[model samples]
Target chain A: MSVSTSQALDYLEQLPVQTHRKLYEQPSTVLAIFRCMLPHLAKSIVMGMLYMPTPISSPDLDAWFRPSAAKLKRSSLEILEKLHIVSQKQLDAVKHTAFTLSPGFAKSLRQALEGSGTHRSFGVPAPPTSARKVSVAELDDYARIQWESILFYMVGSTVGFHGGGGMARDIGKGTRSLLEAGDFVGKKFGGGVGITRTGFMFVLQDTNAQVWSLLIEYLKHVNQLGMSETDVLSFLFMLGSLELGQDYSTSTLSPTQLQMLIDLTAFGLVYRTSENASTFYPTRLATTLTSDSGALSATNNPHDHAPAPSGGATQKGFIIVETNYRIYAYTSSLLQIAVLSLFCKLTTRFPNLVSGKLTRASISRAVQTGISADQILSYLDSHAHPQMQKSVPFLPPTVTDQIRLWELEGERLECTDGYMLREFPSDKDYRDMVKYAEDLGVLVWKDDGERKFFVNRIEQMQEALKKQGQRRAR
Target chain B: MVKAVRGTLVKCDASIKAMLVDIDSKNNNDFIIEELDEEHMLVKETKVNALKNRLQQMMKDRLKDPTIDEDSGKE
Candidate 1:
């Protein structure tokens, strides 16, 4: 899944069953969730069960996959269960348990796929208007400008770049507070709101994911703003199904979604002439929200995971690095320059060029702000100049190696995502389990005194504990 | 009766752990769920970002930079 899909999926998976049940009422929302928010395996499982008359038997479902695919099947069902799309049942007539699709979700998805619904959930388009018209190209440009302005505002907030004042300063106060609420930018040490680590990662994500990220944050505030969360969500899903260049009628939207139009306009998801416009157009950003990685590769927006585009042309990447660690970027975009200055000690700037060096202090400073060495290296790799691409690794090996070494200088801690096991029944059990965990190569930290341990992987340890229980019973 | 708590295990130098403990104390002990050993901690997954920001701020104030900007070539 693309970052955008995962962002939406993560948000969807956390919603309570009641919310999901309400959200699944809209055929468009159901379709959008089915298309983008589910794992491929989950999608197949959902489709497989959609039309089945009876609850699928556990053994029958298990028979569908090979033993090698057990892990994937397990995770797919886990997602299905989490979304409340599928639930287990004890059949009165049968000897074993079975699972069936949630009736509402199955019905809505069927209606969405078969075009059998009069729900009017997809969206009602305004009749073509020659009086006030916007073309596709115009919409794309508006999105690029509006989206880049928000990005520039973020970049400008960090590092005190005050002179790039045209569009960046025009970001709405509502959007600014949303950024603040998301912890993208918090009050700095001096006075003004500064970019935090979450903000940096948000800036670094691809454009589609950035939109989802911001929108997910927007969803959190929908409740506080007295807007119905289901209405806001279904409207967003409806926007993804909208046809670009076709104007959508504001009369058909609920009051909450109508309010959303003004905000979505600010985020470049929709284009509107004024706040009171009768019609709004979904930009490229909005129309691509439901695509599965197609949006990521379709536009090749220069502000993506690589360097920001400047004076757009055949020059996709412009940053060139030397073995001596000097860096030269042929771009005039101030946003790109600001991003570079985060990690490089820039020395000179010409009309269309900038020169900088990756110094230890500069790299460490960047790392200090929570940008990882891998993020830096991949950014360099993606932005490697055309001539530099002829080489195997693209980036100068020595420079890349030294950059990693510099990052490790300030790092005295490492983290493992796992669990802390404690409350053992006896000291003997603790010693045995810790020994088993150590032998499994999953032991991260252990304390014999407290009869507790930390393990990076817990599945095997859980199995061992179960075996120990059985042994005690024996 | 073995019990396991789901969290992220953080292993660091004793000095860094001290700083982390200081950060946790200042935040009403919101970041860390438990301190398991001298250098091991189980931290809340969601509060990791807040902890990181605090640590970065702490480090920036403590560490002195040796490199000075010599950008005399700018026009």
Candidate 2:
């Protein structure tokens, strides 16, 4: 599971019923979660049921998923239920058990997909004409400069570079404080703000993950400040849906949202002329939040020929890695170079190129900063060049295996944080439930005589048990 | 598999209904043409009768005009 999902689910769990109701009032949030958070097949199930009048019978849904995909289907449904996006139902007349989307979620998702409702939650396009039009390049320039400033603010103080004079802008104090609170930067024993392990890990992430990581941190702080989490979350989702390069009317936003717009502007998620710009334009960073990791990977790597516009806030990768650990990055962006420098030992530099080797030293230095080898490999794989993308494996096999092997040198034990279930009434019940859990792919461990089972994801275990009982009744 | 109808909203609907409109002898001039009054909407011939007659007359007028003879001679 990705960090975003666990974090998102945790946030969802904390929401009061009323908050969920209010959040679901806007269809965009429903659509965003439906599109981005659900597994591939979960989406299929949701769409299949989105228009149907009756609850989807549990048996029918079971039949719908292929036998081989039974586990995936069960896991998917459990996630949906846990998030309160769907519910299981029993109607006495038919003696049928069915699954249905939670009413609020169903209605809002329908509105989102159909683009109906007066909510105007998708951000009303600046009423057909706004005289002050901003070009995509201007927006990218704004995003890059603003984002780089924040990064520099964090990394600069450590390297003894105080922004090197007259940059486009310096990151604001609030953002710096938030970063410190998030532990992205820490006060060292020497009393200077030093880039922490989390910061290093953050810097190496694809731009999309980086954006989410920062925003999630910001969300936590917002919650701490006695602000409404629902307002902050819904506003963030609304920002994600806004069209890049088009200004959105701020009049319809809440006070918390209005405050967020300013903070978001500082982080380069949006652009505005003044502190009180009537309308704000979301950058590509803001808009691509709901896109899948695959799309995120494509957008980040320019050499992948993903057709992302050059001047937008979309990330473009230019690095090529080989099985022999040789690396060639075809870019001159200073920020990119700085990031690469963090995890790769530089051997040469050309006018429009940089050559580096992923040596043990480089990998260990990064691992020491709390970035795992898997993170580095995944980043490399995602940003692999187009030619590399065409191959069966994105990253070179030798390099990928070696990175893991090196990390294994440091990591000897693996730990899973989850719950254990035991003390079933009978062996039959235990066996039946264990199989159900296994089918859902949530059974981490089980002991036969002990009549005990363990599941890494508890949300699914409960659903499986409920479903098993429904099945037994028949 | 169900084929999805795709396009601007108007064109999607237009593609469904426009098959009935007669274009062969109506001069193919549809510009500025309002959809024929609702009562005669279903009958192709009745809807196009006036436009068809006007088109034939215009073509004949163009052939008979003296300016047409002069333009052809120059060419």
Candidate 3:
């Protein structure tokens, strides 16, 4: 799974079971979750039990999966159980635990797969005779322009770059406040924009992940707006299933989704002829939301291979770096220039090209702003010009090493905000809980001799310790 | 009973840890919550950034910055 899918999946998994049930009522939402949210083995498990006449016994599941693959089986089943997709039931006749796919999930997923449902969860297409004809290229351009407004709002303000004199000023009030709430940006000392660490990471993530991150924030604040969370989520999933350049009807949508349509239009996910246009087209951004292609590889043309970026924008890798650390980029897009200006000290700019040099001062300045050396290097690597692609390593090794050294110069200590675990009742208890914490990926530091450890999280360790305490009392 | 203390864990070399301890002491003993081991210590959660800035300033005063061609290296 791409990092983007994991993010959305994490949010979905945390939703209450009741909300999951409501979300599963929609075929499009169910289909989107099944396609991108579930682990590979979980998907296979779901498929195996999808049409089964009876629930499969837990022992039978063990029989199906090889014993050597037990861990994978357990993990996959755990995820399925968490999502309420698969429920364990008492087989009254057999005296065993049997797993059945949740009725709502099974039915909706089946409908999605078979394309046989009256739920009309999928978007209703606009009539063929409709005058609005949007080409895929035009849709891509629109999506790019609309998405850039949000990005420029976050990056431009912090870096002191104004995205002057365009529709960039049409940044919606709803979107701006959402960014602030998400800590992607905050009002600075002078009442301008200050990019928080979370905001910096959000801006650096790929276009698709960026969209999901913002939409997830929107999802969080939906209840305050008196909108149904399921309605908003299902509409987003419905947008994912929609075809690019194809227009859909607004008449079929609920009021909350209609309001969402206005917000999503601001985000550039869907485009309409006008504010009141009855038909709207889902841009490349919307179509790629639930996609597994990783980044918003909006271009339907498969051969356009530029392994996309967690960098700012522009899919075509346009940067070229020399051994001396001087850089040249061929592009006229302000968004692209603004992103480049994050790590490089630009010396000259022409209509079609900009020249810059990576200096120690510039890299350190970016690091000070919470942009890491690795992010800068990956941005360079992924966006390396086509000519530079002929080389073994995309970026010049010397410059990359120097950039890392400069970033490392300022780093004296690493700090993690968490709890330190210590003073266990028994040696065995300390050892066992430390092992569990290690497995949970929360153990920050440990000393077996001292019988104390530091952990980045505490709830699970607390539960284990409590259980151990209970066992001792028993 | 296993006890968990809530704070920010800082990891550095022994020298840096000693410097942090000295810095914390000079700051009226406000930054550190507990010192766990040779290279690890727990400090006040909200004071991590302020402590970082202090460390950076001290390093500037104590260590010589070795960048020679930074200005002239750029085009």
Using DockQ, give the best candidate's number.
Answer: 3
lDDT of 1 by residue, B4-56 (tens): 89888888888899999999998899999998778888999777767877897
Please give the ranking of all candidate structures by lDDT, highest first, separated by commas. Answer: 3, 1, 2
Could you tell me which residue pairs clash in candidate 3? A184-A199
Instruction: Name the regions of candidate 1 deviating beyond 4 angstroms.
Output: A92-95, A165-167, A294-315, A416-418, A422-474, B5-8, B12-75
Q: Give the per-residue lDDT digits (tens) of candidate 2, residues A391-468.
A: 878787888888888776544322333555666666787888778777777665555865765566666567656666
The sequence of per-residue lDDT tens digits that candidate 3 reaches over residues A1-474 is 788888998898889999999999999999999998888999999999999988888888889888877767877887898899999897785457899999999999999999896998898998898374988767666676778778887777765667564524668789889999988898888778878878767776777788899999999999999999989999999999998778999999999999999999888898988999888999878888888764344444754433433223656678999999899998776667777888899989998789998888888888887888888887788788999999979887898899999998767789898988888888988988887887667888988988888888786678778878888997
Please give me the total number of clashing residue pairs in predicted model 3. Answer: 1
> All models: lDDT?
0.83, 0.68, 0.84
lDDT of 1: 0.83
- Which wins on lDDT, candidate 2 or candidate 3? 3
Chain B alone vs. reference chain B, TM-score for every model: 0.80, 0.26, 0.83
In terms of lDDT, model 3 sits at: 0.84
Q: What share of the true interface contacts does candidate 3 keep?
A: 0.96
Q: What DockQ do you compute for every candidate structure?
A: 0.64, 0.00, 0.80
TM-score of chain B of 2: 0.26
TM-score of each: 0.81, 0.71, 0.88
Identify the runs in model 3 with alpha carbons over 4 angstroms from their true place.
A52-78, A86-101, A130-132, A158-169, A189-191, A194-196, A294-312, B27-29, B68-75
lDDT of each residue in B22-51, candidate 2, tens digit only: 443244644212232221122222334443
